[model samples]
Structure formats: C-alpha cells, structure tokens
Target: MVSLSGSWLANGGGIWMLAAFYGATAAYGIHVGDRSSEVVESTRDVGDAAANFAGFKISTVNLSGQNHVSPGEILATAGVKPTSSLPFLDAEAARMRLEEMAWIKRATVQKFYPDRLDIQVVERQGYALWQKDGKINVIARDGTVIAPYSDDPRYVKLPIVVGEGAEAHVVEIVEALDLVPGVRDQVRAAIRVADRRWTLKLRNGIDVRLPETGLDGALASLAVFDRDKSLLSRDITVVDLRLADRVTVRLSDAAYEARQADLKARAKAKKGSNT
Candidate 1:
C-alpha cells in the first residue's frame, strides 16, 4: 500500500490522484500469462504512464564496460521502453535478456527510484578468426562464434583456424603453438585437414605438415631446423613431418633445379680431376 503524504495529495490534484491509485492497484495484480498478456501489458502501460507523469520516468541511463556492443542494442535488448517507469522496470529480467546477446558475457541492470537506469556489461573477447564453408567468423576464447567476420580491425591480427570442426578444438592447437613461438610467430593459419590433424600455413607460403601424433615434438623439431639450417628461409614448398623417422622437405622448382645442377657440376669436376 502506497501512503501519500498531505503535500503529495495537495499537489497531485484529483485526476493525478485517481490515476495513481488505479495504477498502484493494477501493479499489485500484475502476473505472467500467455492468455492475459495483452491485459497485463495494457495495465503496465497505464501504470507506467501514470508514474511517469509523477516524475518517476526513466530519463537518464548510465552504461559502462561496453566496447564492442552499442548502447542502443543493450537498451533495446533490455526492453527499456520510452514510457517505462523506474518502479515498473524489471531489472533482473532486463539483465537476463541483455546476456542473451553473443557479445555480452554478463550484464547488470539497475533502476534508480526517480529517473535513472544503470547498465553494466562485460563483453566477450574475440580470440580468433574461424573460416568454414566460405564464411569467416570471430570466435571467443572457448571457440564460441561471436559474429560473422567483418574485417574488424580489432581482430585482424588474431590467429586463423579453417575447416568445419576447427572451432571446437582450436584451443588445443593454439596453446600448442603458443608453446613454440618460433614457429607460432610465422604461422598464418592452422588448417584442420579431414578434421583430424593440423597443417600450419606459414606467412611465407610454406606448409608445415604436422603428424597426427606427437604434435609438440614435431613443432619443436621444425623450430630447431629453422634455427640451425635457416630451413624456413630457404626456397621450400612443404615441410612434411608426418613421418616420425624423418623430416621430408620439398624444395621449390627453382631450388630443386639449382641443387641438381650443382650436384652435376661437382660430379663433372671430379671426373675431370681424375683425367
């Protein structure tokens, strides 16, 4: 029961007093139902209108912790209508609705008594870019797809994973790559082949084929080869590490011909020296 003071009674006049009384009674009878939703909605609109006329309308909004999502999106998701009054706004319900958005990790909605609404949102971070079926998306750290790729400058430098099921197991490969920065730094994309093993595409167009088993050891060996023999800098097309026994490197066509010519020249020199 809302007990109005003498001063409020004097200021509200007869029409405002009657509306406020009816609104208060309607508020008390509010309930959730599919059949009576229209009735409830009308009553809510009436109550909020009356309360708004009494200067309880939500006129100001304070929003924070939002970087990627726009303020309008949050307000719309929260169902903050133009005629919504502080007393009628369901803060907890609004918060749950806000969190349904992909970017919003969590959200808090608060209504101040007179005329203010406050919203705080913790947004999810874009961890990597995932490409599949000719579409690219920004994915969260846990591999949840946040949104379709828009070439957003913020996520341009993120590591890329390609294939159908790569998003689900991206964390494992990403963590393994992190352990070997020497190879990781040069990786352009981690392509999931047959949804089984990963083939890393380097920035220089070199494909590093990793074994289905012993992934870490293969990457470590590749790093050592790069460090000692400057293998990565050489004119190589593919570095096949699928076989545990050896690292098979396929040289570029030009490099292969150059190597063959050098071997022949050495052989001819030896034959001439014998003469």
Candidate 2:
C-alpha cells in the first residue's frame, strides 16, 4: 500500500509540472501573437481579453459629480465598453477624453482592482445664451461656449447676449444686470455694440443705449425711472443713456406723430387766447 501511494504521488507531481509548462507556453504564445499581427487586435484589446479571462473584468462603474452630462456619454468618452477590463484601463487617458466634452469642466478616473472603476466629473453650468453671426450657443459663467442653443428650457430663460466678443465679456453685463433686477428682469437681451459697450433691449421693445463708462449708475437710474415713473411702460422705442447728464428718449412713429399734433394744437390755442 505504501509503494502504491508513492507511485500515485510521483504521477501527481508530473501532472503538475506538465500543467505549468502548458501555462508558460500559452502565455508566451499570446505575447508572440500580439507582436506579430496589427490587423488581428490592438495590444490593449488583447490585454483586456487576458485580464478578463483572469477574472479582472470590469463589472461595476461608480460615477459621480455629473448632472448635465449623461452616464452613457461618460462611459463612451472614457472608452469603458462592455468588454473593458479594470487591469488594462488607462485612467488618465479616460479623464482627458471626459474633459474634451463641453459640459465637463474637469474629470477624474480611478480603477479598482479586479472589477470596478470610479469616474468623477465636474460639469460646466450654463450661465447665459450668446448669439453671434446668427448662431446662438449656451455659455458658461467663465464665457466658455457650452453648446449650441437647442431650445432647452434649462437655458431658455437665461439672458441673451448678441454681437461680436459678447461671449467673452458676458459675465460683466450679467453681473451688472444682476445688481439691478428691476432692469434685469425686464431685459430680453443685451447687445454688445462695437464690442465696446452694451445696449439693453427690454422685453417691451425698448432699446436702451448704455454708456461705455458709469454702466452701474446708468442702470441704477434706469431702475429708478422704471420704479418711480414707469418709464419703461411709456410708448418709447429707444432710450439713449450715453450722456452722463440726461436721458434722451425717442418715441415710436405713432407716438411721435401724436406728440407733434398735440404740440401744434396747444400752440394755436395759446395764440388765439392772446389775440
């Protein structure tokens, strides 16, 4: 019985040796195969396949810090496919791809050993709408264009800025308007004139030409006028606030004609009374 047990142990050792040899040969063959053919598959894909076979397949992706961007977009951008493996994933490269998206301000990626990945992203917030050369886009607070206008309600109510160089300087006017919500709320758009000054177009179809300097005081005065005298509700087409001392108003065609006729009638009545 002892001799029989010894023979069995020897045969078991031989079987283990043969298994080791086969494993080494298989690994070397895979290495040679990866180097030999470019058309067969990329090195990354081969590594991913081997890693997956070794029980390192990516089974879970923990994503966070995303709102405007979707999970699918993040996964696609990071190249995390159905067959991706954690052992072969490039975290830094995936981060760069995520940041390439307009909505993503910054991104981070991490791979967990065996079967998990963690992706975090900070998304750009839509600050306003900028229109130039007949095209409109959603812009971030720092003036980066987030995307083209798609009538998304999330950005539809934002203040519209038009003209050249508006996107880069929109924050200035937006902050200025924010100080005076009385004027800001009534504004439909802010047009950048000659890339130097701003002209506020009110919702009531009134164009207010603002001075290049003392913008805050001008907006404040406009707010006062709207608050006290309901100036914005008047039948005026334009309000020129370029001059520091006075506000010049241009009436609509109908209002202008009516005012002219009323002035003429008052003058005739005064002349007849004097006679």
Candidate 3:
C-alpha cells in the first residue's frame, strides 16, 4: 500500500488526485480480454509509481579508473538520462557501449538502487608509434591502434616501428632487446625488411641487420659484442648478425681505408721479423 501525500507529489499533484485523474481518464465497456489488459497495465503503473516514490530515480553517477577518455563521453554513450530508473537499465549493454570507445580497453557499468549509476574503466596504454602510408598511429601493446599520432607530445618519445607487419611482430623485437636497454634506447626505428627480417636503425645511423631465425641468440651475441668492444660507438655503417656463426661489421669508407693500411703494416712487420 502506498500513502498519498501532497508534499510527496511532483508538480503539486497528489497521488489520490492523480490516481483519480487516471481513473476518470476514459469509460471502458466490460469486455473479456480488455479487463485483463487493463489490470496488467494498472499493475505495471502501480509498480512504476511505487518505485518512483521509493527514490529509484537516478541521482548519482560514480566513475572510477578513467583516464584518456572523459566521463562526459562515457555517460553520453551509456544513454542513461538523469531521471532514468535503475530497474530499466541494461548494465551489460551499457558496458558494451562504453567499451566500444578506442581508449576504453575494458569497462563495467553498474546501476545501484536509491538512484545511482557507477562506471569503471581501464584505459589502453600507448606502446609504440606505428608509421604506415606516411601516417603515424599510437599502437597498444597487442598492436591495437589507439589513435592517429598527430604532433602529440605524449607519444613523441615512443619507439618508431615501421612497415605493414611491424605492429604484430613489434612485441618480439622489443622483447629480444629487453636485455640490452642501453643499446635499445639508442635504436631510432625498427623496420621490417622485405616482410621477412628486421633491421634496426640505430640513433647514430648504423643499420643493424638481424636474422630471420634464432633472433634471441643473434641479439644475445650482439649484446655481448657491444659490451666487449663498444661496437655501437665505432665508425661502423652496418652490423650484420644475419649469419648465426659469424659477426660482420661493415666500416665507413675512411675507416675501411685506415683498417687496410694497418693490416698491410702488420703484414710487413711480420715479414721483417721472419727475415
């Protein structure tokens, strides 16, 4: 039973007056199916009235774990009006709608009684910058494209990955170089070469050729060589680790000439010692 009070009524209309108003709305001739339909409608209306009287109208909307995406956008996507009823809200559908946004990697929408709705969201993290067709995009760890990179200062410092298949294999490239952060930090870009192998362009303009197979071993060997010989700092143009058994370092023209002169001098000194 619901008690009718003048103060509790909306727009200064009492429940007794409103109920009477609806009661006198129309004259209904007694029919077989009409009575059942009217009873069902009346029952539904009473339930809605009870719910409204008990303060089930939406009053609070709480949001947490949101970043990158604003709360206003989420609420708009949810389509829940300020006076929406908690009973009619589809939490799962609202959650799916919220997750449709690119920035929202995952989300949860829940409606509480006594007029409140809550949203929880987990935003995607920017992993690297992917360049394709001269357009750069911020990519997530799993290669999901977040948004187009357009002079965004936040993503300016991320590692640049290029080529069509680079996004999918970028995780492996980063993982292989994880053990060599010192050298990895100096990497300007990681390019997928011929859609088969990877070539790392170093900050100093040296192109490090990585092998198609046994990448871990090749990277490990490079790490060891770099640590032992300060290989990256030398006047080397290319560091080829394509062959599993040998390391090939291509020198600049000047360095190659200097190396040839030093080898000839050593050969001559050896011949002199023998003579």
Winner by lDDT: 1
Candidate 1, residue 15: the lDDT equals 73
Q: What TM-score does each of the candidates earn?
A: 0.79, 0.79, 0.74
lDDT of 2 by residue, 102-200 (tens): 999999998878577889889999999999989999999988998999977898898899999898889989999999998999999999999999999
Whole-model lDDT, model 1: 0.83
Candidate 2: where are CA atoms >4 Å away?
Answer: 1-41
State which candidate, 1 or 3, has the greater lDDT: 1
lDDT of 1 by residue, 90-209 (tens): 799899998889999999887777777889999999989999999999999878888998867898998999997899889878988998898899999999999889999999999999
Worst 10 residues of 1 by lDDT: 1-10
| Residue pairs in clash, model 2 | none
Clashing pairs in 1: none
Clashes of each: 0, 0, 0
Instruction: State the lDDT at 135 in candidate 2.
Output: 93
